[model samples]
Target: MAYLFSGDGGDSDSAVVPLVCLQPFPLLLFASVPVCFILSAALVMMMKVPAFCYWFGCLFCAGMSAEMKAMAMTILYVCCISFLSFSLCIISLLWVFCSVFSAFFLCFFWVLLIVRDCLVFVWGAKIQSETCSLDSP
Candidate 1:
């Protein structure tokens, strides 16, 4: 029993179903984004569990299925989790990078460029000091 509206500005007691509920790809896809993110974050944290217990759960799945449906489902779940977590993490990092870059570009970017130029002038050239001479071989 769902509410259906009539365009005549009147309430009609008719069961007029909307097309969205029938073909829900767009809605489902929108819903899956947050669902996958939450489940993937949980799955990532669950990786801290001991391998012995994790393998035991997987072996239990193997024993439960003749066609390997249970095992396949578990593997699929793991793969989806890994994919979602990595993708969301990457997207968030990129978003942060873009936000920071935009903020700098909006303000203080010229100051940073000036500082870099002053450093270059004093040091003669930009140098790679990643290891700070600790990893020199």
Candidate 2:
């Protein structure tokens, strides 16, 4: 009971690590820390540049009043956000799905697919709105 419940006994001279400390759970947790950080960094990178383009195109494009620019920006954001939400949900479903039976690498493929589709979407919408605004009477 002493070894399981307490960290040290009267013979505290032992150099060995504790049984609990040597478990795989701790190792897995520490291992997952870097993966979490990497995943977060990737999400940030995914959002950042699109944000830059969103702002730049909305603010810098000529012949648009503040209201129109705001509306276009809102539309762009809605589309991007909806697509992201949908993709993540799909990924979550996929995670439950194939993680039960197969390798984890398929998630990456879906992520790439979403990223490509999102980029295409956001940029296409941005361009289309800008063109329509320019073509307006």
Candidate 3:
């Protein structure tokens, strides 16, 4: 039977088994970024601060995750409307410069966050050793 031979056909959807599937830590940590961003946005909104940056970051994480899963078409489908809204702002000349600057800042922050999370994972033992050394010193 096809089911017996293919073992449920789960692999049909995924072109390749993800690196995340191999090492669970990175996947779990990466997936949590969106949740953190969303929660931070909620907190900021509660405190009456602007929450756009946090929301943008959450969207970026979701988009990136979709892209990572070899779903470029899906990402395009979902993010197209948001991208059009941004383009309209640029076209209408409403806070165009500010939008560009904010986009750059968000990109920088995302890079930093990813590096921080990855470094925390990669050099965890080294960080612990250094912290212990500092405390003793």
**Can you give the TM-score per candidate against the true fold?**
0.33, 0.34, 0.25
- Which numbered prediction scores highest in lDDT against the true structure? 1
Give Cα distance to truth, residue 67, candidate 1, Å. 6.3
Show where candidate 2 strays beyond 4 Å: 1-60, 103-137
What local distance difference test score does each model get?
A: 0.55, 0.54, 0.48
lDDT of 3 by residue, 7-117 (tens): 223454222333333344444445655665565454434334233334445455354553353454345434544554554444445344545655576566556656755
Model 1: per-residue Cα lDDT over 51-136, one tens digit each? 43345466665345445654555666687677886777766666566556555653464455456557655665324454456578
How do the residues 1-137 of candidate 2 rate in per-residue lDDT, one tens digit apiece? 11222222434532333444334344454465566556655554544453544544544646667686567556656666675666556555655554443333434444555676677679999999999999999
The parts of candidate 1 lying over 4 Å away from their true place are 1-67, 108-137
**Which prediction has more favorable lDDT, 1 or 2?**
1
Pull out the clashing pairs in model 1. Answer: none
lDDT (C-alpha) at residue 79 in model 1: 79
RMSD of each: 25.7, 32.0, 25.1
Lowest summed lDDT across 10 adjacent residues in model 2 is found at 1-10
